[model samples]
Target: IVIGSGDLAAGIADQLRAHPDIGYDVVGIVPETPDPEEGAVSLGEVEDLPRLVREHRVSDILFVGAGHPDRVLGTLLVKLADAPVTIRVLTDLESITLSQGVAEEFLNLPMLRFERRNLVHLRPWLKRVADFLAAAALLVVTFPVQAVLIVAGLLARPALAWEERHDYRGYPHRIPLFHDPGTGWRGALFRALPPLRYLPSLWPILTGALSFVGPYPEEPDENRAMEDWNLILTRLKPGVLDVTSIADHPWVPFRDPAGLNMYYLQHWSIGLDLQIVLKESLRVWDKEEGESRHG
Candidate 1:
């Protein structure tokens, strides 16, 4: 079964029809929008997928479509979860292609074998425990610095700034930081020390709103048009420190932010999380040391 009425689906249908020796049938196309290609068997709308699947006895499903790809793919996956069918998805991201398992090219068309694996589901308890303990310890150790920064921020700018940022599931939460009120040297002091600005974020980590290591948070507006693979990363809790930002590898500089986050999600383990935390701690120490020498 093919899901989509776009040119891609039409082209695939044409190819399969032309080469019957390939030993597979084109089956039918399920169009999300109206008006599938002329004379194509329309398998009702996307909402009727379950009925169509049962009626057609679909052994395999080929998904090809555009527009809000994440939502489209997610919806299809949920519908076919228990349907005993081999799933293949066409996507532009090579990371997704590799992560989904065995990737293959058919007639120069790249497709990923869709097998869902939930990283969080693997060891949720262990991850939560690590997050809680690490966040608490860091907060306790940074108390003195936080105190100094609070005073410095007040002197520079009487009002602190709280900005709303979206978490992994697109839930909005406020994060507190120092605002530069243009008080010259005092404002510069607040800006120079990142520890001061990020101290309040620890509260979110403690409260389970954020994680110690995961994909970094981006503004909701900025991520509105993110691709399906990138959108999947948002399902993970936002972290204060991302592996991509502190991995200390030469290849780290060349990787796209979304690709790096996806890599973390795909290869996530408690041990990997510990490594990220250790690397981040060293990075912070180096930054503070440099600041002290300059100050």
Candidate 2:
């Protein structure tokens, strides 16, 4: 559905409706004026918006025209706060992404989103399920190596160390790891096998407290949860591997965790997660191989 109907609404609606491949099905419109153009699927005037949205089950809402806060726009935003619909406004303005709103192209027209929804989405759950299975499989394959490490830790007398991290919703997560192997061939071997440090995290994945790919967990910090993007990251469990840490080109200058994490959340899918996992394994192998050759 679209708000502020006129030429802007009609043009955008027609373009999206014409292109089936674009995946936008404009079901109806909500003009600010009572008199919308003739023959358009005008649901009703501005006052009737909330009712129309709930009645028609609108998944997305596009507000036409310049995004200056008009009385109608201001009221509509507050009213629709609890509604589970994605909202965007058509704008040619420069991007103000990465903070409160995100800018993106909607059928070639620049659109701005004023809100970030931490709502329950099926894709996130699908991601969790996929991570859970991958973790299970890795644990099974590396059982022998894990057993050997456990035995070594036992004999070395500094078996395990517990570290504190925060998980979803600022819940405390106690992570267990084999203590430092020390400055010897044993330590070199441990460094060569970076994944050894993360084997304990596999169980959390099985328990749905971690993912195979997502935003890397930050150490306990009260301020992190208060930031806009960081607040969004709390929507899901931290991951065993940060996607860009493995998939991003080494020469790229942009490496801010907030920006990279926001990008990951915006474009995540099961296929993307699998691709990241494959790249992560290969990258780790390459690193270990290069280090071993030099060391």
Candidate 3:
């Protein structure tokens, strides 16, 4: 069961609904009215979250809400401390890293289930919805800013700004503006407004070349070099944003990278994916914002 009736809640419900082995059911409870979507039903207000869990025999509960996820999550934890319901919390807030105090109380109930979560029955459908809304919102908000940045960068550093250069074999590679490089404008625009990076990959995602959330795609040669490690990371499609990319970890050894991805895959869930995506979006956005300011 998932609590809260916001997008995150809906996304989680979508994941649970997709997992066949889990045999999961979702109950969305909001302070106001709720909409019944897929296998989920409205369970009234936040006060009724525990009751819904009990009634539905829910083995797991994911918290997907808007505004101050930690605060909302803390409240739910306090309320359900003695309710015998395992809970998961989702958030985009970067301030309050999950505290050990809270994690101890909840016993870290919302475990990440990277791979298994993908096996979920409703995941494909739910991910499509979440991707659509997220990409649409991003495009709407950033397109203009991106266009301005592109024009400015093209005029200022028409030679493909030194920093914007892509390096292959550790050598700087720049495509000229005089000749239309199909990827030039769009690439510069995305690099300037990194939030739209996902826009380019949306089609690949829909076509199964990508997963809703996973490792960022490595360059082909780099990908091939890690034949051994590929055993680990190759199982999933590259996500536009992911743990390694978000964490800004350099030297992503072979495949395991200190077994982070392995652990991530083992404990991945829709909530975890939400957390990672949000974190990555911030990192990417900030990097671009910094570049824009400097440029």
Candidate 4:
């Protein structure tokens, strides 16, 4: 069942056509707009939902784009939670995704999560601890290579420019600060490397503006999109590496990995942090053609 004849609805249909294992029978497209483009089977506007539901036999409904998902979904939950056909929201909420229904049998989650107040307080401290550790470790592991890169950067006389990559999008990628202006690119490369990426982040750790492994601190303009990853970072530090970032994209568990600076918030933990780091190092960093397995 597909909703909204917009790109999201079309995109989901595309993905479903690509992955048959998804086990969904996508028969119709529902668009609020009067005229849907070519090749689309429009089920009419979302406001006439009862007719749409009846005509499409949409027992297990998925809201593709109903505006405020939280509010709109709440209404659907009240009306349809008791329906025998299981409903699911799309996973890739970036634009549109097939919302998978939470299995009823597994609804009882056992993990205890961090409270909002405690999570807020823990954020600053978690990064500081992670920063010190990451810096010290990277200094040891990459010292010789870093020295060569530093010397090459000094000799290269590379051009350094500070440009606003995206003004409307608040994620400002500034010219990375460097003592020797020529070495900015090298610095950028070094920072992109694992563990070393956290070195520059240490400064922020000192200032208390970030945590070691929390969600990527929202850029000033990112509050709109922050809702997507907020749950993942609620109790975790936004670290040098995101918890979800792994190599070969191999099987990153829904849980937090161990040792990459996680808090007790949101059923996340240090163990989960470490697992992510290990996956990053062994599977992600090890080879180019790695496949990530997700649960």
Q: Highest lDDT, which number?
A: 2
Point out the higher-scoring one by lDDT: 1 or 2: 2
Off by over 4 Å in 4: 2-22, 28-42, 45-59, 63-122, 158-295
Give the candidate number with the greatest TM-score.
Answer: 2
* Candidate 1 accuracy as lDDT: 0.64
lDDT of 4 at 255: 27
Query: On a 0 to 1 TM-score scale, where does candidate 4 land against the true structure?
Result: 0.41
Off by over 4 Å in 1: 1-122, 152-159, 169-171, 182-186, 216-235, 241-261, 270-295
Instruction: Kindly give the stretch of ten consecutive residues in candidate 3 with the minimal lDDT sum.
Output: 161-170
Q: lDDT score, residue 287, model 1? A: 84
Candidate models: Cα lDDT each: 0.64, 0.65, 0.50, 0.45
Ranked by TM-score from best down, the candidates are 2, 1, 4, 3
Residue 244 deviation, candidate 4, in Å?
9.7
How would you encode candidate 2's per-residue C-alpha lDDT over 1-295 as one tens digit per residue?
8775455466566656666577777877677666635435677777777887798888888776444636666767888878998876654332233344677789996565667664222266678778878888988998897788778878886777766555544466666766766566557766777657667777878898767775755556565436554566777776666656632442221244544555566556777777787777777778877887897
Tens digits of per-residue lDDT, candidate 3, 1-295, equal 5556544455445655555455665554453234456224566666666666677766677665555456556666887777777766654332222321232333656443233223222233555566566656665675675466556556755523212222211223222222123356655656655654344344444455444475434454643465333455555545544555423222211122323454454345567677777777787789777976897
Measured against the true structure, the TM-scores of the candidates, in listed sequence, are 0.43, 0.48, 0.33, 0.41
Native-to-model Cα distance after best TM-score fit, residue 197 in candidate 2, in Å: 3.3
Q: What digit string (tens of lDDT, one per residue) describes model 4 on residues 1-295? A: 5655456566556656555676766766655345646334675554555555656676666656645446545555565555554545544333211121232343573222323343322342454566566546755675676566546656774422222221112244332222333235664553334333334444443444433344433345434554433444444434434544531221221222321112223334455556655666554333422321221
Worst 10 residues of 4 by lDDT: 95-104
Error of 2 at 171 (Å): 7.8
